[model samples]
Target: MPEKCGTGLSLLPDVPRPNEPSVGRFGEVLRQYNVRLWAGADLVSVTGTWMQVLGVNWYVLQVTGSSTRMGLAMLVQALPVLLLGPYGGALADRLPVRRILVVTQVLHAVLAAALALAVFADAGLWAIYAVAAVSGVVSAVDGPALGRFGGMVAGPARLGTALAFGSLIHSTGRIVGMAAGGVLVASFGPAPLFLWNAVSFAGVVVALLRVRVADLHPLAAAPREAGAVRAGFAYLLRQPVVLGTLALSFVLGSLGRNYQVTMAAMSDGPLAGGAAGYGLLSAVFAAGTVLGALVAGQRAELTTRLLVGAGLLASALQVVAAFVPGLWAFALVLVPIAAAAVLLDTTVSARVQLDTREDMRGRVLAAVGVVGSLSGMVGAPLLGWLSEVAGPRAALAIGGAVCLAACGLAGARLVRRSEPAVPAALATA
Candidate 1:
């Protein structure tokens, strides 16, 4: 194995200084929002859910022995977000977000618990799909509300770093839960893994209940009006900054960082490692995400420089991962891959928050989620078919190059723009 200059991969400026003052000097969000507690609870629940994800997928395949059914099950799980993101965002703006979150968490708890019970009772394949579909709907309602919660937790100034916390917890949670799911499934079976997922949601439910509703700042007057939907769409049309950010986000999510799908295929197809190889691949990629979060946390504010650098590194790493000859080398690339993933994702999220106003936050957040979910929807089938026909390396290499071009364009826009570049209609506050 070639020595990984893992620490020395300076393909881009590793990260940049944040725009905000030091957390301590300005009254850190960690203190003001009690962000740690909320973040920690989400960490536990999401991790458990991720664990259940692996078990559920494995179970679907094990029971049905049909790759088609497994794929459909995955599709069903995400279908809710595809259908409901806009409505969900509207609801987030209308309802009290924290209360909505509590309801969502409880529903997930029930879903997880029911799955564990049904599996224990020897449920069939179709039954499992039904349960997963229901869970997906609940998540569709839950996701935008979760996205809006960031503003409440950290306010505007610390939103960047606070979101970095969510990103970090999300990656770490997935890794921890996936590792546990694999172990539990290997030892006891899918039922036990799901049972623990329910328990994890229980933790989230408790934490959400403890949150002070009074602390949450409400969305303003206009979005609550009757014709807000028309206004929301019109708002984007009028603002080049919002339009461009959404375009960049949609492209990035769709074509930019699909190494997850490609990595699974690569581990077995070109690399010849099979299941264990895929597992190792996921671990390394997740580690890269975690590293990115940590680096983002240290920054007080997100900068345009950091965003461009992260995107460049992400594209460069994907290209290298595609051509890298050996498993060890492929795995080695993940370190920078993870770093760039977090860097690009968190900064993008923070930028969206900065660029949107409080009243439209729900719609704006929901819109971004909708676009991201749509990207995955479009990318999944195309990437799968392309990999099948042209091989995994081609899919990644082409995807990486396209994604890099997107980053370059976005970087140019940022460099040339003199103003803060938020959506114009909402810019008045």
Candidate 2:
């Protein structure tokens, strides 16, 4: 077991404590009205986002009736992040993040609305893929800016709390959106869900407008240079902790975290579930994430051990969940799976924010996004192919096995780093 600080939570180590007098771990962090306000708005937008996500998945599944196409759609979405995410991170360093955020949110709303129009007009698969590709482009840039925007709103001192709350809000939104998305999509269609997401984007835009710029502890804009992206890469390579975290993220993200694909396949293939069934699974998963985020929030420190342990545990749960005989039984097993997943995910995110310099935060996160996207690029279709060949059960088993192999490899690397080198003279003697 990892040792805990006096705060009595050590899911990750060395998290800076908030000084405000409050009873719980998040008390001091949530006390900031701006942070609270931001979280509230974020919750609204995230709910809508999840609704669209579920709609997209279900729509594709209905249209193609093939998990391979579902994986391909996801792959299209990841391409931009894999290619342009670093440049986007560099731009985040030079731009007013607030403005960037507002603009991006608007773009997202527009794209969602456009997609709704296309779907309503009975657009072709190519049109859907094109819209998805464009959405991915916006996300490549939007992701880094949005990530570091939390620090700008809450100040560096409360960054950990801000991130924790942010994840919690996202999970909350997931629960609502995923739960309702199925029923709504079943009753209405994907059109309305897309429009709902468009409207939801307005919430974040308004919240961003309301934020007092003077209150922000903004980092000085990084000067434009040819080496900007490269510099960010070099800086990240030098940090062992961040490097380890990213490595874990790559493996876990690829093998275990592509749940949109995995869950869809599981629902369609094994459970013979419809929209409502997928929604229930999504909600159950989100519920576990909320619990995990709450527990992770209380921890002031994040460590590699926690990252590794949580990942291993989540992967193991996936293995167990694959063998469950019934839908309810599978959902029951998903609670811990979601908890472990959230813990691993939130820890890596918080660690990246906490460890990276304010000026470089966006870029580093962008680089991380690249790795994650690359993993998804490979993992999504690979899992889909596995499912297509064998079955959903086989896909789950393969992913879990890959995760276990990654953890073992990472563990071995850590062990090798810790061992003493043999002396040449002593060896000769």
Candidate 3:
């Protein structure tokens, strides 16, 4: 078992106390062995996931030469999450998270292998679509379970730092994976990348097995009950801050963050930089996310003001990026845009996890997942259609404008209310 801190929380020996200086909290949280293990595995897994993403998008475009088709592929993937995410989150609340993750990771691996096989066989577009849908089904459960597990691994006191570290890992993976995928796809094809992803899941499974379960600060598993999904919604309706943040996330995620659709179109169309340009943009954006994560990790607390501010900044940057004349200029603009995107995402996630009750965390996270899926479902196709009609630049500008307006309204509301964002009950929790 981990030793108890002064706050009576179970903390690893390396975890800093609440009263400790916050200057190096980012490094301090990582000193926990389990955190390190989780980070290492997450890096590998996320890298693979990004690699698969690049491969799928590129494959679809190469085959059909349509940005609309690329968006349709993304829409298919998000559909299951939109439909089933609540049930997945409810399952996370009832089950052992570590166990659930192990199963889901295995399923992900199997699905990746299936995609690889389909690619190798020169299967039709339906094969790719089917694999994407199945993967989304796995993700609907995996996302919520993973979110809840992070809290258990780091404990509430260090959760903010831990989540920031998670972003760092994810971004690092994106950098490596996107860069490599670009080079590999140019020389080979998407099949090899899919195979590599299938193998990456082993890293996470091994890490889960190695973790000391006794050291985790797990919440009591909620009992099986009807209306469990509705219960999560009811809980969120009561927390104005969390509910508002989710609403903001839905808009930003749909409009401000459909870069996969936009970037691919820009690369193939106006920029004429092709696969290499898209990869470079993806990598640069991820590098910015790394910087943003490091900055976010240093903070001891997150607030609604910070969340809205980050979203506002990112939205402005998106509009700037839409007008860059050349590929390199576009890529350069993406750096700060991606950084602010990370800040916005990390703030919203931390606020949601910190403000919710332990038992309801999974369900709330599931709702978050559903929002993301719904955003992708709506945004991907819309952006794709817009890119096809007015062009990629117009799609970017319009999306950015919408996000900017939404964030502005949300920030103004926060000022007018002038009430504590964190509820008294949760603030004490």
Candidate 4:
């Protein structure tokens, strides 16, 4: 109304501007916020990875009807990571992380496709297991490089949030893929499910290709001592912080984590529901994982309190979930289970990222990865055997008890020492 009536002195309507400074153009968001489109694409491909994971486990059980066999199958997948994961991390640091990722992603895609075709063509169980075993070996190389690239893409400033976002995407993908897998198997059998996984691999491959080198530091080859591998271990041994966090990973990976296979058995046997029940159970738990990831992103650091507390909480959740009375009430426990696992993971990874030097990031992460899988290798079979004889509940009970005790003893001491300065942070516990 008072517009520059005569001399451009009119009052203009106030345009709302962001309280924050200009974030620049759309492309700048990815640059400053560490929001890479390729990361999203890679996550989409992981959906397929989770699908194969479900189908393979189900297929093994279908053939053997033995919990031990199911565990053995998992053992095969994780075994390579136990033995070679650190070496994998070392290689990631030595070479260009980007190039290594490209090669690994392609190999992984090929293996996934091969498995799909084999199952679709009526191949044997041995063939499926063989592919899984071989692919597991390749993952030792792929996973560490992939992990390093996460920090590379996001930079150290946003490492925690980036990790959380990746976790969120991956967890959501797993839930969607796992549910789709259960339904697909019932309707068209596992063949098509495997095929879908194969196709999904291409998505990640393209994403990897699209990422620019300008965004990533070249991971050049480094010549270290004869015992370069042991170097990482040596570093960890000196630092109780890393050692304790790693110990927690080992315990959780080995014992506290075999819920998927156990849940499958429990759903069918105790809950008296079939595939639908299994799928629903899986989806709910994955939903918990997604929620945990979201919660993790908002946090600033993975303090000592978080490391120990999350471990204790996870152990307790496992125990409670096993004892819950009806299916609905029982399923609700998965939320905490998922949340605790993410917290545990976030605590450890963020600690490593925070503490490790830039040069050793790959090697240290590799060592962490190995400890994680090896512990799982040992724990999974034991739980499987326990499940077979005493039933799933018994296995869960024992695993849960062991996890809680370990967290209380080892984790408590470590957290107390690491976090005395900020006593209140122990609420993470």
lDDT-better candidate, 3 vs 4: 3
Error of 3 at 105 (Å): 1.1
Tens-digit per-residue lDDT, 214-270, candidate 1: 765444523366766566666656656556677876776776666667877888799
Candidate 2, residue 11: how far the Cα is off, in Å: 25
Task: Tell me each candidate's TM-score.
Answer: 0.87, 0.83, 0.87, 0.82
Candidate 3 collision pairs = none
Error of 1 at 97 (Å): 0.8
Which one wins on lDDT? 3
- For candidate 3, the TM-score is 0.87
Cα lDDT tens digits, model 3, 327-403, are: 99999888888888887777778777766677788888888888877877778778989999999999899999999
TM-score of 1: 0.87
Give per-residue CA lDDT, model 4, range 378-427, as digits (tens): 77668777888988777787899999998888755776556332111111
- Tens-digit lDDT track for model 2 on 319-407? 88788887788888888888888777766776666556666878988987888888778787788888889899988988998898787
Candidate order (lDDT): 3, 2, 1, 4
* Whole-model alpha-carbon lDDT for candidate 3: 0.81
Worst 10 residues of 1 by lDDT: 1-10
Give the Å shift of residue 26 in candidate 1: 13
The CA lDDT of each predicted structure is 0.72, 0.76, 0.81, 0.69
